[model samples]
Target: MEISWLEQVNADVPLDDEWLSSGEQLILAGMKVPKRRADWRLGRWTAKRAVTAHLELSSHPKQLSAIEIRPAATGAPEVFLDHQSADISISLSHRDGTAVCAIVPSHGVVGCDLELVEPRSDAFISDYFTTEEQTLIAQSSQEQRDHLATILWSGKESALKALRTGLRVDTRTVSASISDGLDYAIQDEDRADASVIGVSRGWYPLHVRYEERQAFEGWWQCIGKLARTAVSVPAGGPPIRLSGCPRL
Candidate 1:
């Protein structure tokens, strides 16, 4: 099935709680940490907007209030419309004021992640990544090391989310690798619009192996210093941007 994705930043979230459902409001009120509350709001806002766009529903605040995103027992976000469960699978990730949501058909499982391309300590690589993943990073040039590491890490997180275990499972249980010989260059024109970032670069195939077995297939792309990855069980097509949602 075709999976759709949307991106939103902190500025895109509404300041008022009018768009949040009663349950969501209660959850927000219970969050004592300001940063956690802000991140939660940003994630919910992005997921609601993505669901509306994917389902072709109204974008009005009142309508959005009826669509709630609640955590399942496994901590995966589940969509609900007017207090009833919606037949859709969604995954969310927020980092550094930016959030992304991935929507897929109900029959399939999906997960997505967004990460900034930054230096990771050697200890981190050894602690979380598989031997092969570390070797790939070590082979990368100094200039590309950060970007490659981010992609691999983000892919692992996405796969973990798809497995519905998140960080509860060992990250090394899953190994991520990019397809061979894929061009990573981004043209100047593509950088002119910061919001569109890597969309123009298109999606590159990513494979994630769980315990040495091929378990999830997905795609990854990078632009500037941002990397996005999405993986799904039963596999999915390259993520298509959901219409009517704000850009990153």
Candidate 2:
């Protein structure tokens, strides 16, 4: 579906597992054979409701079509429409109180992540922090801990997913740093987007663009570390914005 990422995010839809647990009779009806599946059905159901709002469709949510997930060898999700071979690019993310479903045609090989703020154990930071990251973490001011880690974690995870686009770069090999004024870095501010430069073959060959949209308030530590981040990278050259998704 051709829709703006920003507009779809603002559309209201029900996300409660309880409300969707029984399945919407009108949505699933009697298409039992293959449609009764779990995440596929529920996720699609939720997606349709949200998409419908973005499309401003007068049709009931049940009238919306079903979506199929096609994954790459490494496990990336793409939407396969029955009517066409091209899979539309869609990104899904759910934090605590809310979940977001975003889609961009083929070109939108976008990956998104959300995290809440919370307290943490000292050893927690050591688990994922590389030497450089560890230095940043230790030296970070008390007030800056959550914000600092969130940016690094988000940028790292987001970039990790971005690398899925072409090359399966090692998570340990590449790292991210954020700064408001520093070029090729991100700010530790909520909902701020950053452009990063990373090493590929020992050189900072390309700029990796990533965005951070704070999902909720408070300091979120474990959730921030556990939540998977997605990113896209070019196979052979600089990453280019995909115009649309490819046919599966």
Top-TM-score candidate index:
1
Q: For model 1, how does the per-residue alpha-carbon lDDT over 1-248 read when each residue is reduced to its tens digit?
A: 78798888898887899999988999999999999999999999999999999998888888889999999999999999999999999999998898999999899999899998789999999999999999999998786778789999999999999989999999999999986422352322135234655352467889999895657899987766678899987786789887663332
Candidate 1 is scored at a TM of 0.92
Enumerate clash totals for all models, in the order shown: 0, 17
What candidate 2 gets wrong by more than 4 Å, as runs, is: 1-46, 49-59, 70-73, 83-87, 165-170, 181-248
Q: What is the Cα-based lDDT of residue 126 in candidate 1?
A: 98
lDDT of 1 at 63: 85
Q: Give a tens-digit lDDT track for model 2, residues 99-181.
A: 44444456645554445544445676676556677687678777667655665565565555444533255444445554332
TM-score of 2: 0.52
Model 2 gets an lDDT of: 0.41
Residue 58, candidate 1: how far off, in angstroms?
Answer: 0.4
